[model samples]
Target: MTAPLAPPGLHTTSLDLGGRTALVTGAAGGIGRACALRLAGAGAKVRAVDRDAEGLAALADRARGLAGTVEPHVLDLTDLDAAELAAAGTDVLVNNAGLQLVRPVEEFPPDVFHTVLTVMVEAPFRLIRGALPHMYGQGWGRIVNVSSVHGLRASAFKSAYVTAKHGLEGLSKTVALEGAPHGVTSNCVAPAYVRTPLVEQQLTDQARAHGIPEERVLSEVLLTDSAVKRLIEPEEVAEAVAYLCAPQASFMTGTSLVLDGGWTAH
Candidate 1:
């Protein structure tokens, strides 16, 4: 059966950002790709940043007919200075780059943990710092952090990812408070188990870490806390990101727009 369509006035609307510039990290794939496309479709010049040069190229190609342009920026977020430099002058900053490892805290590799924190937390801080000068000068900006359900709650094995997300949550709120007087806003879009490469990899890794078959991980682990029995789509999370960047959301900041399928209801 087809879903009922909303009335014209009830339908979602796009914000005009014709002269804006949006920077989306991890834009080579998944949620980042979706955000990049959504903003580009809304007439913003999008800087799609990722270390995956080929993926960025394909993304740039796919965005050809958008209302604006998608320019791929190849960089590893671990290069903090470079990441900050790349974020300079962007009106919208989507900090979506992330990595994961499913292992008990004691068993988790220290180096990997450091890397995750660096990319997910510190890099976002630098990016915000770099973008802030321009945004304050222009008197407007949007900062969206693509966090996870892990940011709010936690699971047993994903120590690094959960820790990084939790830190990101605090960072976002702090920035929001500081940016409020400058017409800049910062918030987090926290979703659970989005159908993205990162989650797919987690499924396999979780199965191994938990001593379960990969096929059982979905029902037995990943979706166990979710009242809804499916993973979210990348596009859905991307739409939430776009909404937060819209003028209508000017009053909304220092908050989390959660898409957890009721996981947090428990």
Candidate 2:
């Protein structure tokens, strides 16, 4: 878990998501949970989707404290019908579900690569296709994809992850262009290393892969590449996701909001 970086006594008021129905994929974990909670906190009726039944239940329980209702749905995003069902009647959709694999290109498993692409790219595309009618009918909608800094740059041993993220950004932009005329907007949030269970697992895998200490992997490998010298907090990403869903954000679309602590500044 990364520590909060926002300065003390400087809080931005959250927008009201009231009366809006939102579907958040990968809502059981990290950035997904933060986005879900933030949307719900602002009064959106949230449907939290995850493959983990128990985790989804726990997330739903947690949302109750935020004075928002979260309905848990356990379904594989690879299933198009399931994705459509989950997206029905949703005013906002957050495509946050994804997988990351670190392996040399020559050793990358074809099946693993295909599956990652299915989830990170194909699934989100299908969800957008499924959700578009409703959004267009209402003349309002928001689609926020959780991309990565890796999408903009290359990294060792991450061919499949990088490919999927880059493809996702293209899809986001294309959708934004198509939906702009319909009052629907598509955008992406690209964050640097976020301290989540998935990232912790990556740290472990990377440490073992490079024969380096875990602390060294974090400090030397992760933070070393970022100007902020720290992992981004999931909440920060969530806040940005919520902002993009607001009425004030209607003019913003088809752009990658890079929150890499200036990792790409160079």
Candidate 3:
């Protein structure tokens, strides 16, 4: 059965970000791509940052005719100084770049754990550090961290990912407190498993780690706790990111807007 649409004006987002600029890391694909497109649609010039040159090019093409524009920027987040530099002068920062490696704690590579934290946690700190100056100067800015259910909960074989996300949650709140006096707001959009390349790769790794067929991983693992019984779409998460940046969310800060399909309720 088709669901009824909301009355026209009653449900429109009506967010306008004209003349603003937004920086979305990992914009080459998945949630980052969706966010870059969403912010651009709201008339904000979007800096699409990712190391994937080809993917960035594709995103630039897709953003053509948008209300604002997509500017591709190729940079590895591991370069902390460069990441910070890239964020300067931006009014909006969406720290959506991330990675995951599923392995038992005993077998997880130390190097990989370090890399994950560097990219997901440390880089965001630098980016926010860089953005705050401009934001504080203007007394207005929006910082949206694309965290995960891992930020609030835990699963075996995801130690590093869980740790990094938990840390990100803390960092976001600190920024909120400091930036509040400057008209800057910081928040996190924590979603359950969203349909994306990262999650696709996790299915294979999870199957290997759990000694199960890949086909069984989704039902037996990924969505086992989600009452909704499906993965969220990237665009759906993007809409939540957009809402936080809209004027209506001016008073909301330092907390997470969870899109977890009731996973935490149980």
Give candidates' CA RMSD values in order.
3.4, 1.9, 3.3
Q: How would you order the candidates by lDDT, starting with the best?
A: 3, 1, 2
Q: What's the distance in Å from true for residue 235, model 2? A: 0.7
Instruction: Please report the candidate that would top lDDT against the real structure.
Output: 3
Score every model by TM-score: 0.95, 0.95, 0.96
**In model 3, which runs have C-alpha deviations exceeding 4 angstroms?**
1-12
| Model 2 residue pairs with clashes | none
Worst 10 residues of 3 by lDDT: 1-10
Which of the two candidates, 2 or 3, achieves a greater lDDT against the reference? 3
| Residue 124 local lDDT, model 1 | 97
lDDT of 1 by residue, 1-266 (tens): 11122224323457777999999999999999999999999999999999999999999999999999999999999999999999999999999999999999899999999999999999999999999999999999999999999999989988999999999999999999999999999999999988889988887788888898888988889888988788787888888998999989999999999999899998
- Residue 102's lDDT in candidate 3: 98
Model 2 TM-score (2 dp): 0.95
lDDT of each: 0.92, 0.87, 0.94
Question: How far off is residue 250 in model 3, in Å?
Answer: 0.3
What is the per-residue lDDT of model 3 for residues 53-145, given as tens digits with 9 covering 90 to 100?
999999999999999999999999999999999999999999999999999999999999999999999999999999999999999999999
- TM-score rank order: 3, 1, 2
